[model samples]
Target: MQSVAKIRLADALVKIMEKEGIKYIFGHPGEQILPVYQALRKSSIKHVLMRHEQSAAHAADGYARASLQPSVCIASGGPGALNMTMGVATAYKDSVPLLIITGDVSSNLKGENVFQNIDVNAVFKPITLQSHLIDDPDQGIEIIKKTFQSLKTGKTGPIHLNIPRDILQKEINPSLLDESVEINIKTHWKDINQVKRLLRKSEKPLLLVGAGVLWSHAAGDVKSFAEQHQIPVATTYPARGVIRENHPLSLGLLGTRGTQRANYAGKNSDLILAIGCRLSERTQKGLGNAPIIQVNLDKTVLKGNINIQADVKEFMEKISPTSTKNTEKWLHELQSYNKVHKIRTNYDKTPLKPQMAIKEILDGIGSSILVNDAGSHTTWITLLMEVSEPSSLIFSGGFGPMGYGIPAAIGVSLARPDKNVVVVVGDGGFQMTSQEMATICELGLPIMICLINNQSLGIIRQWQELYYGGAFQVKLENPDFVKLATAYHLKAKMVDSPSEVLAAVENGLKLNKPLLIEIKVDKNEDIPLPK
Candidate 1:
């Protein structure tokens, strides 16, 4: 008979993380989570100590978005755990997979008004796919397995495992746990005959994709299907990179900040094939009553006129090529809209128009991972920036949270060392998580952040100007960002004119260390919206 080795529950937890192929754990250590921190020190898995618990979850969210794999984050109970809710809710809304382990007060202290103790399981229930409270040490590993299983199957989202301090410190037998369970989610492959029939009958067909396509690794499939049938494609915010923006058949993004051609194409199409997208109001508003052939792994979201419940990749794999009705005139009409509604990105303003600066920067960096923080700048970047590859642009789409760009850029830089990472953030949003510059400097990550300094909460101020009287508290007083970056041991520069934009970007790209290039723009300038 084989003998089972005894180990601390915290140590056993690390073993499971290792088995799951997790490379790094991003979080902060606390009094309650000391055991896991102690175990992490002796294990090979690297732990990134974040300054704020919220940024830890954002970093993990970024890793999952970039890698298309679930990432783990840890938080101490009470305030620490509560701070992580926004990140978890953001992931859930966007269908990003994450496993968050929170450490609570000791089991004996439950219901005794102990420090760092709350009904965590109840608080996280609405935001997670599954929330498990491990009350017994013997069943802790089992709960971990079940959490991962839930993450692997069905529509991917965040999951939480609450471990009391005593349970994390208790001893457990390692050999008794199962280590070889399947991790891939099973798919119910649907027939594509009806889809083919719809394709043949339609005169103008358009395809809309979202983050689900990126999560399932179906970018190539999406591209192939579009090209094979000569159908035009557009994507939501999170799916910006799934279809290369430079493709001739691409309509760019569609939403409030979308291009005019994309919106026109989506509104006029006779038949719509929405794949892996939830078609939220942001993507579906004002879209005419067109018959939609929706394909998704989650049946709840497959309520289109023609619904197909299947994996997007598998559906594309099994699809048979067939002749379709002519769409050349429709394509030409969309192309004409592009010319009539072209956005002015070549302004020669002295204080440099934000769009012109973005254009110059894009010209300098051909194709790289772009991260955008939530603000007026997000609208400009998503509408103007060209994506040349899939999974190359990360956005806080569902939650639209500020302070996501800097930390997310760090995570992407760490995950893809071979590629360059660029961040575009407004002055207001940049200040929210600028402290992550310390983390970037500590890790020596190669990322270039283009801070758009408008010196106000640009978007909210715009809202105030249009609706209600002009509100105060919108203007901001910021530090000298260049000096701040220099203080953090990073190369920095400030651009005040259009002529200086490209050169600054070129210089930032040459450095092997972190860089922050601040572009000063007019605070009163508004992001151009589609007419």
Candidate 2:
């Protein structure tokens, strides 16, 4: 610690965050967090105040997914922190790098009948990669460093740090940062013999890639291996744009709504080389109930169809992309499968399907950054949207959180100011965090947000229709997003017919400010997940 003019402890907290390169945070101010608010007012860290804590948490999750960078969120104690727990869990499960900062009852007041005091650490422990209480103000720097290191370690996820009201005002020395040593993380390696035997022996091989591919920016390496060996590729929803959809070996997406070619190959492959993906039902076809060689950083993934637990990068690095090998038989067969059904863009002719509009956005945007919120709207987007680059598609595959798309688009735009960022969110999910439009407006960060106004939580409706004989409740009704967008002083256009979509999206993108394009999607559109 060094001496300086007396500064508010809260200001010091914000300063530490700013020094770590956090551009913005999504949060809701509350009484327990009043001191944080007071300090934030004077600090350089910009916060997006949301209507609910969950939305803020999801937005942070979204931000992390979009930029491959850590995103932050703050909430009041008790119900406020409780409200954000699921979203935090979503990020943790999905392996998103997020920092969730929650306010708590004064440290001195804990267990003394204090208002807004809850065991946030206990509740967050199961979800977060790490959870800590800032018991000593002087230890703030150390806690933050370790928190970030833990959250950013291989196969990163969310971490939680609770700052009590009284603790936020304690001043501490900055010298701790000098004494902190950054540690290197070694990606776990696999048995060379096992991996070598699998690659050398397999005749029918298929490569399934996911968001982890882009997270590590190994699309080039994966592509190199595939091209060298002529391995056909099938992507999961979260990994839609990891490689060009039209590439000779790329099968776009795999699952119910995925291309028929991809699914057929999954069913036939003797060796399913799944990398950076958990092989979710939509992608794995329930693990194909077959032999699968899954490569992921998480050891828990081994419980499923996974045969090995080595980091994808580590394994790929060890195995030379065998120019000596050929997968011609497998590639030819899968291509034949791709040719079987002749995948069609039927939504173009269908009556106002949300997927049709999604196609239009993809068609017009080419390869711009895309963020898909969790829900049915995501289903339509993932199945229909086309992208040309790796890491271009960002979605909550494991940490499925609604209201994540829009705020994450803000982060995308901030991270890559030159590129256009688009967010696709369902009406039910949109309204949950639509208040963030204020944040978008305040920053004047241009982003095009498409709200699929289906008037219901489409995914839950689909689930009810499937297993519960359509016993849908608490999934109905949606607010007018145009009105909500107007209140936030952001430009918004409502599209009810197919004819109005392209022009509205174009106008929205052209605007120099935040814009929302709301499409009156059919509530009856029972879209299914892509295979």
In candidate 1, what are the lDDT values of residues 142-190, reduced to their tens digit? 7787667766555778999999889998898777366444444545545
- Residue 246's lDDT within candidate 1 is 84
State each model's CA lDDT, in order: 0.83, 0.74
Best by lDDT: 1
Residue 124 Cα positional deviation in candidate 1, in Å, after optimal superposition: 1.9
TM-score of each: 0.94, 0.87
Q: What C-alpha lDDT, on a 0 to 100 scale, does residue 172 get in candidate 2?
A: 62
